[model samples]
Structure formats: structure tokens, C-alpha cells
Target: MTESGRKLILSYYVSIDGKSVGPTNGMRGVMESIDDEAQEDEYVRQLWEAGAFLMGRASYDAMKGFWPVAEHPSAAPMNAIPKVVFSRTLDSVEEWGASSIASGDLAEEIARLKAEPGKDLFAIAGDSFQRALIAAGVVDEYRLWVLPAAAGTGTALFPEQDGPLRLR
Candidate 1:
């Protein structure tokens, strides 16, 4: 944390079919198989190099259940890295390494984090968190990875309510 606030960096792996609709459709498949562990290792290494991360409560639960016992070398460090889960129900995260429930206002905490000295902070979820950040005008940049195909139906990633998003 910094005197001003922390810097909030958000990152996610999303597909063209909006959000929840195809995020788990297995389209990307497993880039790293058990036989070829090096590929997985490299990806994990890159993630670790990313520094701190943030995720919504739902995303946090899903991740906590999956990564603690994961065999990937990066899994341990990734799980151990500093994380903040945003949720009203979770008083605190039980699965420990180095994680804390966010306090004060969402944007305020993010600002505090951004003010602190560190590598880079990353938001590691989709839809809800992204929308919140966008709505708050806190996001710095976005990288959309387009796929070859698209799903006709599923969850959409656009913001709710009536407003215009003027893109450049």
C-alpha cells in the first residue's frame, strides 16, 4: 500500500463470445499437457512475474478451490502471491499464503495499491470486475484476444444501462 493508495491493475483471459457465455467452452483447450510440462511452466513463470493480482469473490472461490493443490510449479507461487478478493460475504479468505479482503471503497483501495511501489498489479477476472472498473473510469488499457469463431449466445460484456461508449 502507498500513502495515496495502491495501483490497481486488472487482467483477464476472455474470448470473443462476450464473457460468461464462452469463457469455459474449452475453445482454447490446454496449452500445456502433462507430458509437455515446460509450456505450462513458462506460462506460470510469466504470471508470477506479473506481481500482485485482484479478483472478484466468485472468481476467488473458483481459483482457491483449483490452484492450491495444482501440480504446476507456478501454481504454488501464484497461489502464494498477494491477492485481494472483492466480496461482501467473504469476511476473509481462508486459503492462505498472502491474501487480504479489500477494505474501504473499491476504487480507493485500488488507488492506494497503485500508489505503492511494486512490479504491476493485475485484475484477474472477467465481466463484473471489468465493468465496475470501466464504469469507474479506472482502467488504463485493455487487450482483447480475438478467436477464430464466435458463439451466438451467452453472456455479453457490454455495460448495463443507457450510455454511450465512444471508442477511438
Candidate 2:
């Protein structure tokens, strides 16, 4: 948990090629492509359980188009959480849901959130943001969901590595 009354957690879904498939495996993909409604419901439920959510500008824009009218069971929860977006040009978060702009420095903001009284802040997408947090040694945990498939090559999840990481 964070000191400012929030917890920072990063969540990601990766393919065999290490690509973050937002367009394909993202919101639209889950709603239109996936055949399982139960899976979507469960994902939303889990997403909502978090006290807050953070995402990059790109991811936030993509979500703005889909999550509003989404009828999945998790929609209610997703619509309720406090959303924080990282962006410079976005004047205000006027999306259907309640959202706020990142106020402080990334690491500082995250630390304050971690100290807050909450379950954990969910880091929703933002590959670059995740990498920065990991490199900064601020990310406490890394939960990478390895999907059951493989792509020969494309946008990779692990773009650049400064050092070798020992993972269990």
C-alpha cells in the first residue's frame, strides 16, 4: 500500500511474442472477439476490486471509447474506481467515468499512493510506464499473464533490458 492512501499495482497480459495486444486483446478484443462472457465478467470484477487504476494516455484513450457502454457484469465496478491518467496534452478527463490527471511526479505519486489505505492501485497497461517504474525499482510486484499462444514477431512486451532480472 502507498503512504498517500493508495496502492500501486501493475497488471499486464502478454502474448508469446511479448506483445501487449491492446487493439486485438484489449477492450474491443475482449468484448467482440473473445467468446467467453464469464471471463470478461471475472476480469472486470477483479479490476474493480482495486482501489484505483492508472494507465498511459494511449491506453486511457482506447478505454474511453469502450468501457462506458460495456454491459459486462464488471462494468459497474470499473465505472466506479478512481482513474488516474498520465498525459501532458489532455486538459481534463471528461470521459463517462470519473477520472483525474496525475498530480505529482510519477515515482512520488506512486509512493504516496502505496502509503495510502487501499487494497492496491492497478496499473492498467502503459508498457513504457511499467518499464520506467520497474527500472526505477519502485514496482513491488510483477504479474505477467502469459497467454496460451505464440507470435513469430511484433511489438514486444520486453522492449529493452538494462540488466538481467531473476524471476521466480
Candidate 3:
């Protein structure tokens, strides 16, 4: 947990070059080629521990289409855990199970969620949303799965910072 009494965890799959565009071109193949069952299990365990998922419009859109239909080992927890999609344009999120739309101030909304009694919040969003969170200095921990290959061209996971962030 953070000083706010709730941990904000940012988890993502990045390339060796730090690109975070999901499974584009040959990236998915590269990621799958690495046979690491233990690591995969640990990642799934972490996902199961999250109290809720935080996502942007893009990730929420993509996940809503896929996770609802996909038959995978992580599907159960992925569907069970509550999700919050931060989008100003979206009026509602009924299609995505256990989800709600957050159209208000991002920081305030997150703070409210943090104050509530729950497990750590897991963040998985598009670059723009993630950039906003990083700029706000709200994330408590970063959990990245660095793949073996490069994405060639895509969004960088971390944006330019005004100052260095010290991590323990």
C-alpha cells in the first residue's frame, strides 16, 4: 500500500525497447515464444490480487471485445474483478461486466477509490491515460513484463518526466 493507504500498480507488457503497443505485428509471436510458465502464473496471481482494474477508453474497448469471449486461464478473475474505465465520451459501461465509467476529475476519482476498503488498484491503459497518471505521480508500483523483441515503432510506456522518480 502507498501513503494514500491504497496501492496503485501499473502493469503492462513492454518490449525490450520499452514499446507498449499490444501484440502488434510479430510482437505477440515474440512474447509467446518465450516459454516461462512460472512467470506467467505469477503474473496471473498478481492480476487476481487486484481489487479493481483501471483502464482508458482504448484498453477498455479492446478488452471488452476480447475478454468477454476469450476462453483462457485468466478469464475467470479478469471477468470477476471490478473495472473502472476513465472516459469523458462514454456515457455508460454496461456491456463490460462489473465496470463503470469515470468521467469526473481523474485524480479525485482515483483518490476516492483508494480511500475505499479494497485491494490494490491495477492500472492498464493506453499511453495517453498512463501519461496522465505518471504526470500526476499517483502510481505506487510499476510491474512490467519486458519481452525479448522490439516493437520497432509504437508508444513508449513512460513519457518524459520533469524530474527523476526515485523507486525503492
Instruction: Using TM-score, give the best candidate's number.
Output: 3
- Taking every candidate in turn, the Cα RMSD to the unseen true structure, in Å, is 4.7, 3.4, 1.8
> Which 10 residues in a row give candidate 3 its minimum summed lDDT?
20-29
lDDT per residue, candidate 1, 1-168, as tens digits?
Answer: 333444444444444654433345554442121345654566566567556777778878878877887886767767878887777778889785677887567777777667777766777665677678767766654544344345444455563747765444
Error of 2 at 59 (Å): 1.6
For all predicted structures, in order, the TM-scores are 0.71, 0.77, 0.90
C-alpha lDDT of all candidate models, in order: 0.63, 0.69, 0.83
Whole-model lDDT, model 3:
0.83
Candidate 2 lDDT, tens digit per residue, 1-168? 333555566677776557665554443243245566666666776786788788778878877877788886656776788888877778898884789887567787777667767677788777687776766667665667655555344356557766776686
Quote model 2's TM-score. 0.77
TM-score: which is higher, 2 or 3? 3
Better of 1 and 2 by TM-score: 2
Per-residue accuracy of model 3 over 1-168 as CA lDDT, tens digit each: 866778898888888998875655467777767778888788889899999999998889888978888887677778889999999999888887899988889899888888888899999767788878877878888888888888887778775755775666
